[model samples]
Structures are given as C-alpha cells and as structure tokens.
Target: MVANPARRAAVTDAALELLGREGARAVTHRAVDAEARVPTGTCANYFRSRSDLLAGIAQRIFVLLAPNPDRLDELAELPVDDAGPAYAGYALERLLAHPNLARALVELRLEAPRSPEVAQPLTEFLRAGFDMDVEFHAARGLPGGREHVLRLHHLVNGIVLDALTIPLAPDIDPVTQAKDTARALGR
Candidate 1:
C-alpha cells in the first residue's frame, strides 16, 4: 500500500490520543481509525501490528515534543550559568503545552517492559535524545557533563510524571520546580 504521510500522522496522533485518554488497552487499529476519522484498516495500513502501532506512538510523542531549534539556539546563547535553567524552563513549557503527549509517552514507557518490540525502539529513541542532549550540553559548554545530563533526565522524568499524575507538591508550579532542579543539578 502507498504510504500517505498525512494519513500516517493522523493515525499516530489518533493512537496517541487513545493512549493518553484510555491507556494502552484502548489503542487498536480499529479504534485508531475511528479516532482519526479515517476509513477502517487505515491504521493497520500505516502500522502493520499492535507492536508497530505502539512503537509508532512512541516515535510520534517525541516528534511532537521535540524542542524548537530556534529556541534551542537562543538558549545556547545564554551564559553557562543561566543556560541550564533557561533550557529547563523551556523544556517544561513545551511538555506542559501538550499534556496529552506527555501522558502518551508515560503510557508508552509503562508498556515497554511488557513488550520487547516496544522496548527496543523506545529505548533507542530515548537514548538517542539523551545522547543528543549530552552532546549539545558539552558542545555548548553548558554547566553539566554527561552525568549531570543524566541526572537532569531522571529528575525531569520524575517531575513530569508527578505533575501529570499525582503531584507531590501541587502548589509548586512544575516549571518552577524544573528550573530549580536544573539549576541545582547544573552546579
């Protein structure tokens, strides 16, 4: 079957919505087709199996959440002392902007352990993003090294997960929490 970029994107997006709203159990080819408002079998045409569909949602989440290059360039121009928190704030803002996307990602992460096919691509994509962040931090002479970057990733993951689900400190804004966490870790 000829691949339609728009249709594929729509299918993935619909899958994401399902994953976000109803968890992974609700995401199937037929459900995705209904959610995306596409013809039956359209999701299967784009994603051949359940694993393929889940993996596609994982990819689509990152693509949707990726930082803006122009903004990254702006953050890169900040002083080393200021850059980390600035980037953290920007990243949190982006994640907050798409709560469903973040939730979808959380869903995928949860599913990864049960399915090797899901785990492989998710791990690869996540590691690739982490490596890119480490490279960018090093190349820009940001305040942290690989370990610091790794720490920030762990911290941010917790922060985002908490903010999305049960907030430990609901009164404290997530963005503020992210910036503070980044600043402390950057040192």
Candidate 2:
C-alpha cells in the first residue's frame, strides 16, 4: 500500500498531468502508476476506485492553482478600489500562464456533474475559493459584499474556461476582461 503522503501526491500529480495532457479517460490507476514511476498497483492501493482517484486529482488541482499566500496577504491589506484592478489583472495573467492547470480544472468540473466522487471535491474547491474572496473583500471593507464575490467567482470561472478552450481574437485581452469584471463589482 502507498503509505507516504509524498507518494500519494506524486500519484495524484501524475493523474493530473495525464488529465491535462490527454483527458479524463487517460487517467486510470495503472496509467498514473506508470507515469508517477511508482510500483504497479500503487495507485490502486492508494485509491480504491476510479472515483477516488478523480477526487484526489481534484484536490491536487487546488494545491497547484491556489494563489500564493504572500500575494493574498498583500492584496488583503491594500485598498480595494486602488488595488482591485491590479489584483484582478494579476490573477488573469497568472491564469493565462497556466493553461494546463486551467484545462485540468475545467475537465474535472465537466466530469463532476456526472461523477458523484468529483462533486464533493469540486464543491469544496469552489467553497474554499469563495471563502477566500469573501475574506479578501471584507478585509478591505469593499462594497458589493458576498453577492459580488459570488459574481466575481462565476466571472472568473467563465474567463478561465474561455482561456482553456476557446481561441480568442487578438484584441480580446484577459487582463482587460478581468479589470472590467472587477470594476463591475462597484469598487
């Protein structure tokens, strides 16, 4: 059995890489085992079923994609009206830079509705992200409150989705889109 947390993370990382590089169908336990360079049956030992593996992958996605704590702290201390655009544009730029992460997340989200195992992980990820947004806005006494945070969450998801799948016109800038969305949040 896979007893080490590092080994489990490695297996999940391999599964995430497979999901990004191939698709959901390519992330079987044996494939992850081979990709992770662990012993055969290692992934199976760690994850009892396909759904468990998928859930593990979902968890890994958040670990890889979540913002840096330092950056979050800095943003939390800044005036929202003055710093909101900067934060939004920075976030969009980071998202644009990590297309693979976005693809893996989008893939998991697509799979979540049909797979009960993924649903909890996906919901947890969203909740955590939403909570962070709420804290960030509340820390700065920003208006628009929880509803605005939810709207921004949906907007970010849509922008990330477009960044992953749809090719855009040269002039359709993600940074601009983010800034516009932030502005709509009523400062």
Candidate 3:
C-alpha cells in the first residue's frame, strides 16, 4: 500500500493539538481519529498504539527544542545582555507555544521508562539537556565547574516547572530575572 504523507502529517498534527489542549490522558486512537476526521482504523494502522503516537510527538518536540544544528542560535551566548536576549525570549516563546506540552512531558517522564516504547524520546530529551548544560557551561569559560553549572541548570528547570504549576505571582516578568541571571552567571 502506498503511504500518503499528507494524511500521516495531518494525523500527527491533530494528535499533537489534542495532546496540547487536553493533556496526554485525553489522547486516544479513537480521539485522534475523530480529531483528524480520519477513520478510526486508520489511526491504529498508522500509529499502531497511543504510546507510539506519544513517542512520535515527543521526538517532534525534541526536534523543535533544539531545531537543527544551530540550536545554540536559539539563544545568544552566555552573556546575553539586556539589549538582545535571544535564549530568554526563545524559552518564553516555547513555553507560551505549548505550556501544556511542557507539563505533559514532565508528568510522563516518570513513567516513560515503564514502556520501552516511549523511552527513546524521554532519554534523548534528558541526555540532550545534559549535553546542552555542559556546552552552556563551557561557553562561558567554565566560570563555574561542571557541578555548579549543572546545579544552575537544574535550578532553572525547577523554577520553570514551579512557575507553571502554581501562579503565585500575578505579574512576574521572567525577562528581568533572566537578565539578572545572565549577569550573575557571566561573572
């Protein structure tokens, strides 16, 4: 049978949108079929299982996170000043584009290993972050040792998740903090 790339793309996009809007729990082969306006059997035929679909989506997300060989270009060098902060803006943009996806990723990470199916993207994403943090540290002449930089990266990740979990501040602008952090880390 000939594969229709457009049909597959539509199903994938529809699944992503459903996952984004309703969280992972809402995604099902049937729901995806309905959302895509495709045959229910078609969803199963293409993806085989929900886990497969999730893994495919997760891989897509990782690609988006890094976005090619120039993923570093997403952010300016370590010392992105108040004038031009590419990474800060990019981070915020990513979060805004699909905060729900971020939340789903965090939630699913715990159980990802249970299924070898979903494990690949989860591991890839985790490993990629570690590599990025290392490069992020090295880019600044190792101002802080590996451990210190790793600690900072963890802190940033935690804070981003916390900010999403509970909105304690009604008007907290992350940009200012990002600038302050850049200055502090640059030193």
Estimate the TM-score of every prediction: 0.95, 0.88, 0.72
In candidate 3, position 87 carries an lDDT of: 50
lDDT for model 1, please.
0.87
Candidate 3 lDDT over 115-176, as tens digits, reads 67778777887787778766764674545556655555554565467666775563776544
Residue 104's lDDT in candidate 3: 57
Cα deviation of 124, candidate 2, in Å: 2.3
Q: Candidate 3 clash total?
A: 0
Residue-level lDDT of model 1, residues 8-78, one tens digit each, is 98889989988888888899899999999999999988889999989887877888888999999888888
Q: Could you tell which candidate, 2 or 3, scores higher by lDDT?
A: 2
Best by TM-score: 1
Instruction: Put down candidate 2 lDDT per residue, 1-187, tens digits, no spaces.
Output: 6489988988898888888878898889899999999889999998999999999889888888777878867767766675766576667777777776677788898899999899998899878888987887787777777887777767777787776776465468877887787786664
Q: After superposition on all CA atoms, how large is the RMSD of candidate 2?
A: 2.0
Residue 5 error, candidate 3, Å = 4.4
Which residue pairs show backbone clashes in model 1? none
lDDT value for model 3:
0.63
